[model samples]
Target: MTTAVAAPFRFFSLQVVRTRRLGPSLARVTFAGPDLHAFHSDGRDQSLSLFLPHPGQPEPAVPVELGWESPRSGEAGSGGGWWQAWRELPDDVRAVMRSYTLRALRTGEDGHTTEIDIDFVLHGVEPGSPVQAGPAARWAAGAAPGDRVVMLGPAVADNRAIRFRPPADTDLVVIWGDETAVPAACAAVESLPAGTRARVWLEVPHAEDVQDLHTAAEAEVTWLVKGAAAGPEATLATLRAAELPPTTHPYVWIAGESGRVKRLRRHFVGERGIDRRRVTFVGYWRQGLTEEQLREQG
Candidate 1:
């Protein structure tokens, strides 16, 4: 018999409190749950597994109370009425689940009500695309004030943590990412030592995706457009090839689509011979996988 490991944490039910449009393809959904009291505040780019009920299903089951068993068990204690039916579902036809980042977090006065923000990338009508005009996107775009969903995972350890405490003599720092990786880049920038010299590169599908970021370090910012001839790797290569001040320390951070990020990581750590410990590289998302799938693969 397989022994089940108790989930390190429990999931909470949250209602869609609000929604905001960040871009033509990005929408932010805010949810408030009582379980937020246990959330680790420093988690950014961390993923949460969202359990969305099937269309027309009366309600969703609570993962914690039901344990980490598959939701296919039917509504909790509804009798084995639908349990056997749910168990008969094909592996691929099960209810949909998606992973998304914790873009922002806020705590209520009593610390019981916590609001968290997550962005969903709208993939325009592409068949098989995770964000295609399907049930999940429809649910997110039209989530009602009282509609409930299950939130699992803060997945704290999954993030690539970077701690940068450069020596006083250090000089230059470079950070770059595609829009999906922006949260991590922002977190890294905010954590850098005061007065550090840095350059930031952000790539997005359109000009409007750019947002002003505040940081204490001395820095120059650049925005690159997707589909432009100068891809992220080329852009980073150009910057890396430039002459630098002798005392500048190079702390490089690059993340985004898997292919592009892998290329940049190789160039910086292999060809350029930078110290491995001095660079932080993360593959935030891949070109063609849902965030949940990525987490499973990892």
Candidate 2:
């Protein structure tokens, strides 16, 4: 029922082949489908939109045709895009849409995708948790084999959705991400070439959420646990006190809560004197807002 307006992004009908719990706060779901023949991506921080059916529904209720212009209004291209059509769907009938990062994918001998993985952060899924579980978290917590879903992803290997880009002259790769961004950040770091220098800071809600990253790069990684030394103040303090290796050109990529991302960006550009053009900051979510509210504000 969720529709993306971009033609470059196409819909893929997928089903969960398996699921694995990564930690107390994270789970990995593997999906496969015939529609993956057209799915392609370079994979670094690749962004995707996923659609899920309501409880008891067999499949997501998407429109048969996502035409750019609706002719029913008796006007020429005045109706709006596919997003409008998706919004017009009844609340109970509409699919639950969530944004996720592509963790990894496997290809067949013919170079067609055979399967893909997405890691979900299970926020509020634990018993007696203070925060309430959102639909995506709740769905991911109980996702099982044969669960149907839909994804809006790239048809081209290289697209704008893949944002972890560093210039040719870059000598140091700096990364910071919270639990919500761990999947993308891990994928990006793991793909770095040998001899590359990197400094990574990954913050997770629990100690169990910390993961061992395998990378060819000479990377110094630090994991911060929430109640111990995570969050905006502690994270910033640690970064501020630490010393980075000498490098003429450094590229920085940070994603997480919007407010924290902004403060970290300022620390890199304003305090550390790194070039603003060399930094890429993404706000995956805001502290006090839902995805729908964030989209509406945009």
Candidate 3:
């Protein structure tokens, strides 16, 4: 059933329509649902919460809480209502929740979303990998057509979930993201208008993860291949030594590992002297912690 969790965002039951391997480390999954007629988004770095079922479950276990007077009221009950109830579920029985970005979407003539694409970063899924694959990565790697799932996504075209916003006077757009944030960064880049100037850096574990980005704007995109080292030192060194174009009004967007995001944000605001207000930074995930652990610490 479709449950309205909050205004501009709600739960929609969806099924996997198809899956495509984007690269060695990325997989693209497309989903569709009858209720997607209500799914609306402007699509620049749109954020979403995906709930996946465990291996053999027919669907993600999400109990809809309809006790509120208005689902759009933006208030939770004493125990936080559905969130609390869901949390109270047995660990193995509850749906696996993960935060992701909308990579792309298509609409019909009536302006209803017909399908949406999300790019999943596959980690440790390959044979004999050093790191263990996460739940979402494993689910995505073997995702097949007709796999059932659920999504908490935008119902408003211009919602607060979208973080990329360049002022009208912005002369330059600077962007950086690791593999996890590549989908969001790419969405922001693809949405750039004609004649806009942009510079982007995308870091990935392997060279095969490099993607060909298509944009109308005057954009210079660089793909940084990470070495065996497990930190952002190499990325930071590259940014420090590179030269940027002269622009008084520049907007910067950086996302990826939490620690690295902070470092890059500082480099832009402190080292490059860009206005902090003009820079948008997001930490998609932490290096050593699982998503559930990260949420718990929050």
Candidate No. with top TM-score: 3
Tell me the whole-model lDDT of each prediction, alpha carbons only.
0.63, 0.88, 0.89
Q: Rank order by lDDT, top first?
A: 3, 2, 1
Q: At residue 108, give the lDDT of candidate 2.
A: 100
- In candidate 1 the C-alpha lDDT for residue 267 amounts to 76
Cα lDDT, model 2, residue 295:
79
The window of 10 residues in a row where model 2 has the poorest summed lDDT is 68-77
Off by over 4 Å in 3: 1-6, 65-79
Runs in model 1 with CA error above 4 Å?
1-8, 58-62, 66-95, 110-113, 125-138, 155-173, 190-194, 228-249, 290-298
lDDT for each residue of candidate 1 in 1-298, tens digit (9 for 90 to 100) = 9997434434667778888866655677888766667555455345456767666764454334444334554233223433334334554444455655566777678754378877665555334544447456777766667777877654233333323334455578877778777655666576565687878877776677666677788877777767445565576576567554444357777777878877877777888777777776777667777655675575
Model 3, residue 104: what's the lDDT? 96
Q: Tell me how candidate 1 scores on lDDT.
A: 0.63
Better of 1 and 2 by lDDT: 2
| Candidate 3 similarity to native, TM-score | 0.94
Predicted model with the maximum lDDT: 3
Q: Which residue runs of candidate 2 sit more than 4 Å off their true CA positions?
A: 1-7, 67-79, 228-230
